[model samples]
Target: MAPGEPAEPETAVVIATSGSTGAPKGVLLSARALTASAEATHARLGGPGQWLLATPAHYIGGLQVLVRSMLAGTTPVFLTGTGFRPDDFAAAAAQLTGGPRYTALVPTQLVRLLDDGGAGLAAARTFDAIVLGAAATTPALRERAAEAGVRIVPAYGMSETASGCVYDGVPLDGVHVDLADGRIRIAGAVLAHGYRLRPDLTADAFADGWFTTSDRGIRHDDGRIEVLGRADDMINTGGVKVSANAIERVLCAQPGVRDACVVGVADPEWGEAVVALVVPAGEPGDLRAAVRAELGPASTPKRIEFGAELPLRGPGKIDRAAVKTRLQPGSHG
Candidate 1:
């Protein structure tokens, strides 16, 4: 497709999702859907104003910032000159010329912002809402941000929805969120047409006006949804199925732990073994007892590896395949 040339009748833009591995899928988004998403965000956030584009534009989260800004009739300030850091963020934020400032970020970037003590936290508080997308955030991170007087709105969506169609576990106006066979499903004006060049994959994912997500979730009686980890990520050991997300929450809550990734490793006797790779804050302590006490011995990690940083792929998501390889027997990574 050349510049100024017409895209497919159904699609205005094709945003490729960042997969952990293998070929990335290009999501065919319609102009109507993208604009609807931006409009819905403004409705939920009171009103859109100036936006800060801290993330790369290629990602949906970043792309939505531009859309929201355009819809708001505001010029967005871009973060440049270096990687995501507190001073740079504050400096860029200071350049915003519109009212009710906003920005979108992955949880990892938010963590880095909070790490600078109060400078970044103070800068983040200036925004009317800070949309956290790309991955699920820990309760601890949210509490810390709240304590610092920063507003963090957790968003759930993907390229297929144009951006985040759910905010703080509640579906945005005109959007529908439900569970099908323990997996999350979404339907709304914000939904994309389908995946480009993959009719079979598109057909399998979207049906009956709902796009079935790979993630497992629980829909609250009040219409809120709680996203568990991916369905395939559940660890089964000795006939017991354990939620890796649950264990990760426990591990992250433990003292001296910063971030954690839990994976299932192939085992001879147990079929699969639970393992963890954790980033320690300072002097690490024994984490086994905490997991054992909270989730029982079956869910407890068979082996725990502490690292300085986690291997990440596709918008700050934990590289699980890499983590699994690092925890595999006799593998030194």
Candidate 2:
């Protein structure tokens, strides 16, 4: 089926995972599941309103914007182009004429918009709320957006959940969140039917009514979930277990650094060495010191590489597996 095409019979939509860490899987979502997710999102955001499609339509984040608009009986304004620009986003925001306006974006796009100065700040302030997802967002970035008057809601979910079932660490109405063995599990009306043509994978991911995620997280006393990095994405260097997401967060807090991705590379002595890839080539500038201050010396990256931009899969998510491949021994960009 082509992009944005409705799924067959009971299936409402089919979305493919970005496969940043492994093989991509096609998640099958039913009409009931999609509607449940969209409705819950609208209700959470103070009822339905016009939506701006700023991300790619093929991805769940962007596709949900269109789905929400359809359910709201509103036409979503699409930001057309191969690239996302502050000017384009400003124009799209200007086109919204009805009730409370909203849009979905990844952290990278949010960073770009925040960097665009007056035009970006003005456009960002127009949204009733912005759903930021696809990956973990740093607290530093969130603070910057908030300071600039952008109300960003950090969302967490995957294709199997039909989109973001958790907003700002809280499960949406009708969505149940639990942690088992340090892994995150979700169950709700928004749960997808299963993976398309992959029964084995489906059974492995979803069982006993809960879709098990690859992420590790902690449940707060206040009934909120704080997601750590992926379980598989954890780095073991010199017998020390370190969270790659934590290191990336520290690096992102530094000035001149737009984004950062941390991964464990093969190392004989240390078992696996922690490495960092930063965007826009910031001066390394005490990254080790910062990480040491936040975590410890063991969590510091063994090496830091700079690039014009980090590799992305779709919808502005950092492709860590691709970055690892490019940074492998004897490999070239």
- In candidate 2, stretches whose alpha carbon ends up further than 4 angstroms from where it belongs are 1-9, 280-284
Q: For residue 302, what is the lDDT in candidate 2?
A: 85
Which residue window of length 10 is worst by lDDT in model 2? 1-10
Cα lDDT tens digits, model 1, 1-333, are 243655657787889888764467988898899999999999999887889999989888898999998888899999987778888898898898878999999888998888886567778988989999988889888888899788989999999988998899999999998888999999999998778767898899988789998889998888789998788878889999999999999999988888999988999999999999999988767798999999999999999999998988877777888888899989989
On the 0 to 100 scale, the lDDT of residue 264 in model 2 is 88
lDDT by residue (1-333, candidate 2, tens digit) is 345654545876788888887878788988899899999999999999999998887888888998899999999998876688888888888899987899999988898888887686689898999999997778878888889989999999988898899999999999999999999999989998788777788899889889999999999999899998788877889998899888888898887777889988888899998998888434657777889888998899888888888888866778888899877656677
In candidate 1, the residue pairs with backbone N, CA or C atoms under 3 Å apart (3 or more residues apart, or in different chains) clash, namely none
- Model 1: how far residue 11 lies from native, Å: 0.9
What do the candidate models score in CA lDDT, each in turn? 0.88, 0.86
